[model samples]
Target: MDVRDEAVTIPASEVLLPADLLVPAEPVGAVLFAHGSGSSRHSPRNVAVAHQLNRAGFGTVLVDLLTPAEDEVDAVTAELRFDIGLLADRLAGIVDWLATERPFGTTPVGLFGASTGAAAALVAAARRPDLVQAVVSRGGRPDLAGSALAQVRAATLLLVGGLDEQVITLNEQALDQLTSRAELRVIPGATHLFEEPGTLDQVAEAAADWFHDHLHPQPASA
Candidate 1:
């Protein structure tokens, strides 16, 4: 089915975050994206994955965790981008908005995060276990979620690049801390950004499969 994509402004805390919402016709579930440091909803890599999710009959919300002003400051100072607590709080607020808002409120929700944003996503999942059903991390820094890692109830998938050894170790350590069902998948020949040809496609496919399995159940035979 064709998906309808729209630009939206979501109020979180005292700031309005810009986002792109894409809802497929008869979507099975919806996924919210928390982009990596220095990136916005316009991130090409995340946008590619969102498009893939949309084609898979899943809705997606690509949101900017930082406001324009904060983004400018973060660009110069590089401060807020690494503030996992603040980022997680904003992500939790967005999840709250999704649970109470129209059209999306009733849909099952998942989270897809990249880099440091992955830590924020995990922390948000820990904070709102009842609202978030599943989570996917791409080339992420899940360890930065700290003690919140053990509290996340959502079924989580950590996708790391095989070539990124240091990050792979960190993800493994974080995986050990997760009490919920979680798995680590490494994409061969891919680095931190998965810039290799066809590597990002692998990440998207894995994430789509994970969300499809966990977010909602398939209908029983008629």
Candidate 2:
């Protein structure tokens, strides 16, 4: 089925985040994406994975974590992305808005994050346990989630690259902090980006299964 698109304008401090909502023909759940520090809704890897998720009957919201002005400042100063607290707060705000706002009221919500965004995603889920149902991260720096890890009650799956030894160690360290039902899957022969052939598809498949397990099911199925 062809994926349909819609523009969702989320209010930030003085501006709005221009997010593209990708809807499938019969979506079973929705994922709110938090891309890496340097990445945005425009990241090809994320966009491709969003297509895969859409084909699997899920909707995707790829929002820019930073506004144009905020991004410009971070680009030169290179400081804000590390402020995981603020990013996670903004992500939580978006989730709350989805519940109270007109277009996205009460949709089954999940988080798909990568790199620094994974930290924010975990933090947001920790802060709002009732809203976020599950989380999937690809080649992420989940260590940055910090103390928020103890509060994440949702199921979380962290996909790390086997060859990226440094990040794998970091993920292991962070695993100790997480009290949630969490698992780390290391993709063999994959680097930080998992850009190696067929590696990313493995990430996508793992993500699909995780969401399928945790997302709200139909009455009959449940």
Candidate 3:
């Protein structure tokens, strides 16, 4: 299993976002990661999940949704991170890039989002139904996606922490609005961050299974 890991810059919404792209030899599919509020491409949690997916034969792209300057401002205002529309636009732009510019263009693409990034992923999936095949959210705020929730055609899995009652309620409410194949699984004894022992590992395993089940490689172009 030879793997290629590289740092890349993705053009999205008129900004260049830094990203880490990891692809194993003959990948089964590709997954793009959308980090949560105030997080970056280096998010340890997302990195852990991406590693799991990579071992499961999925290529992954972990992207920073905000530019460095914007991140600086966001750290102070805490407003840009919550701007769902802005984040979704960037995520959608990344999806478009993966479909057109990447060598794995023919491969199916999935999205893994965390926190508010989940809403952004859902919105991106709705916007690019033809390219995005599946989505998985970890402690995500799907309710933040608004009406875009109904437009998503991708199979979606929402992973919530069983101990995070408020987020669980929010996810349940959002589940009803989903029109595609959607399911919510609560990881018992885990909180919002899934920081409890072995909880994050469960999140990674579940996400790997979800993406594996839903995404498959397509015939490459001649």
lDDT of 1 by residue, 1-222 (tens): 688888889988778888889988787888999999999899999999999999888889999999888989999999999999999999998988987784554768899999999999999999999889999999999999999999999999999999999999999999999999999999999999999999999999999999988997424449
> Local error of candidate 2 at 86, Å?
1.5
lDDT of each residue in 80-123, candidate 3, tens digit only:
99999999999999998998887554679999999999999999
lDDT of 2 by residue, 1-222 (tens): 777899888974445788998987677888888999777888998988888888888888888878899899999987988889878888888887766772533458899999999999999999888879999989899988878889899899999999999999999998888888899999999999988999999998899899989987424334
The lDDT for every candidate, in the order shown, is 0.92, 0.86, 0.92
Ranking by lDDT: 1, 3, 2
Deviation of model 1 at 18, angstroms: 1.0
Against the hidden reference, what TM-scores do the models get? 0.96, 0.93, 0.96
Q: Rank the candidates by TM-score, best first.
A: 3, 1, 2
RMSD of 1: 2.8
lDDT of 2: 0.86
How many clashes does each candidate structure show, in the order listed?
A: 0, 0, 0
